[model samples]
Target: MTDSRPRGRRQAEAERNDRALLQAAREVLAADGAHASVAAIAARAGVGIGSLYRRYRTKDELFQRLSALSLDHWNAAAERGLAADDPWEGLAAFITACVEFGQGSLSPIAGAIEVTEKMRAKSDRGDELLDALVARAREAGALRPGVTAVDVSLLVEQLGTSPLLDQLRRQGRDDLLDEAAGARARLVAIAVDGLRAVHAEPPPGHAPTRRLYTERWRRRPEPAG
Candidate 1:
């Protein structure tokens, strides 16, 4: 009977499917970049093509959504970090969340789809928070002499793409996952400590600039006609 499938049941199933699709899209897009196929995403999600099409008409659209979601996650983490009374604790906490959620791993899909104004706005907001967070740490002498917000951003991106973390997430090995987390935490602690002024030795090469960081997301200009 049509009534047997209640609206609540339908809604819950739809939500569940959406979560699966998002997870699959993240993995496939991160792995394959712009060339990732919709079929692969659907397969990874364990959903039919119909379900994928129902939500996203194209793989680009799926990647676009994921890109936007990544910004949202980062911004949320940044805001929470900004709120912490202790500057170093706030910065460390935010960095941990960003890496744990694979926030910067979505960069592989950058420029694959159009970057909308909304996404730009979100990125700008995140930049503001990043600047504030870095300033707070520097004022407290918690961050190194020349560390910039872009440096922290780049560091988070580098750590977010850990192969072991990705593999453990895929394998779902409960036993090893904790070990993986512990390893990640250790690495993060080391990275964060290196940022402190107490450990100051000028970082090799020039510090990353905001332009260099944002360039990754901007579409390259078309060749002059």
Candidate 2:
């Protein structure tokens, strides 16, 4: 006899399949960085490219999903880190987790970075969990007030894998394997301190120099003697 489930259950199973396919895409991207191919991802997911496209219209959509997955993992790690009792230790753990996650798990790209709105949306959907944690720390004097979660997010992006990480890894400098780990922790600490510092905000009406439009006169070549 064949076992049968309700029609609703069948739909749920299909949804699960779709999710699995997308997750497979994430795995492929992380392992190969930006070089992942749809065919390879489909094969890894035990599905066909057509099926994958049915779920994701193009590689761009797939990359968006990959960005979403990366942020989800990071947000979860942050939650666990913030749960620690010691504020400083919690912050340190958070930075370390960020380093660990970014090392080989994320492919840095200008395009992928543009998906930050998707990241913020996903994180916000979780009751602003990560943001709330940071806000709580700031409120408790553990972190500096006026330090938006956006600041922390941007800092992580700035300190993550340099072009050098891959270069060094390729060169067999195993010692540099976790060197950024400590530096990451210190960087986060400095950002927090700056936020907490009582330095006044720039005085009203004082604008930052706009070097974008200004050009320095080129030094004139010495007249041929």
Candidate 3:
């Protein structure tokens, strides 16, 4: 006999399950650190271990899905920033979003609570999108000129790692985090201005000026907010 349950009911159930699992995973990772096991996650989800296994075959797979979900969230936030009519404003918004996302996230899933190489690679892989955005904005004269696609992409990730930046915000240090967020926003705007394609002629066919953009390479801390 065919069941007469509404499709809406099934979809809602699935969503609830996904949310439970995601939340459970976060709790397990946080409580146990990187050594958190699948059993722990299952218990946290209040689901049978088999159910957890059904959704995520391996720990790495589970994390990869979680990581992807996290990225999608931040990326969506970035897109929201891009919705501004002015390109400079859009870029600034995206940069702020990126910084805030990093400060708030990157602790769960990995258990180690740092941006992993895998996640960093995902961000690095967005070069084409960043390049296209920069090109269009520069051509539209939103940028001040002389800035390149590579410059904006690299800096967005680098400046976002400010240890002092995310921590203050997460620790309820709203004043300092607000202070840093504003400063970072301005930084993005300056870079955008520098990158805008200028109408003025260069000395000749001047090569793109590439210099020290990031002084700090080592990993820094911040709460993903």
Candidate 4:
């Protein structure tokens, strides 16, 4: 019992440290992007640099985990949306959940981290869930004919950039933070309304493809020697 107790406590502490590190990394990266230092993240997490390095050898490793967590959040939200009875409401709910969760703020660190197979798999699954959700909405005539799943994905990404979250942290403006969130919610609502099958002119140029969006995050191949 004594041996197991110690091990369990150690595991619990390790998990807590990881959560703190991730939240700190997210905040620091959001404010400073790829240029942010590991020391900054450690300090923000109230841990020493040595402790942070013990878990993540480099900033990329840390960001890789962050990306995975973001994908997890997205996938969960997508699932919840798909389970909703109202197709349009489900889609809108998913979009709002993603944006409000600050998943979009992680985009700046995309190229900095190695896009591993696990990350790719999670992202692809997210795509699948999104495709199913969009199909449900479209078949029900809740979505505009011209809109695509990729379009909704891109729109959520665009809305996910939460600069106000950073501001709320730095400036301690909790009062204004709620106001800012409300404004964002209002914008998202308008965006959802626009996605309805009502009259609208065709968007200029062709709609963006999932391939194009995915490729943007991939590391470019090196030139021949």
Clashing pairs in 2: none
For candidate 1, give the lDDT of residue 47.
95
Lowest summed lDDT across 10 adjacent residues in model 1 is found at 214-223
For residues 118-199, write the lDDT of model 2, one tens digit per residue. 6657746533655666666666666643555655555555555454555665577889868854665566566545654253
The Cα error of candidate 2 at residue 6, in Å, is 29
TM-score of every model versus the real structure:
0.90, 0.50, 0.47, 0.88
Q: Candidate 1 has which clashing residue pairs, if any?
A: none
C-alpha lDDT of candidate 3 relative to the true structure: 0.59
Clashing pairs for model 4 are none
Off by over 4 Å in 1: 1-4, 167-175, 220-225
lDDT of each: 0.85, 0.60, 0.59, 0.85
- Per-residue alpha-carbon lDDT of candidate 3 for residues 1-225, written as tens digits (9 for 90 to 100): 875789999778767877798777755554565578888888778888887777777776776677766667556655665566877666666666665455233343333334457666654544445555666676677764456654564555555455565457446787677788777667656654444345454223444332332223233555599
What are the per-model C-alpha RMSD values against the true structure? 2.7, 11.2, 9.3, 3.2
Global fold similarity of model 1 (TM-score): 0.90
Ten contiguous residues minimizing lDDT sum, candidate 3: 210-219
Scored against the true structure, residue 185 in model 2 reaches a CA lDDT of 57
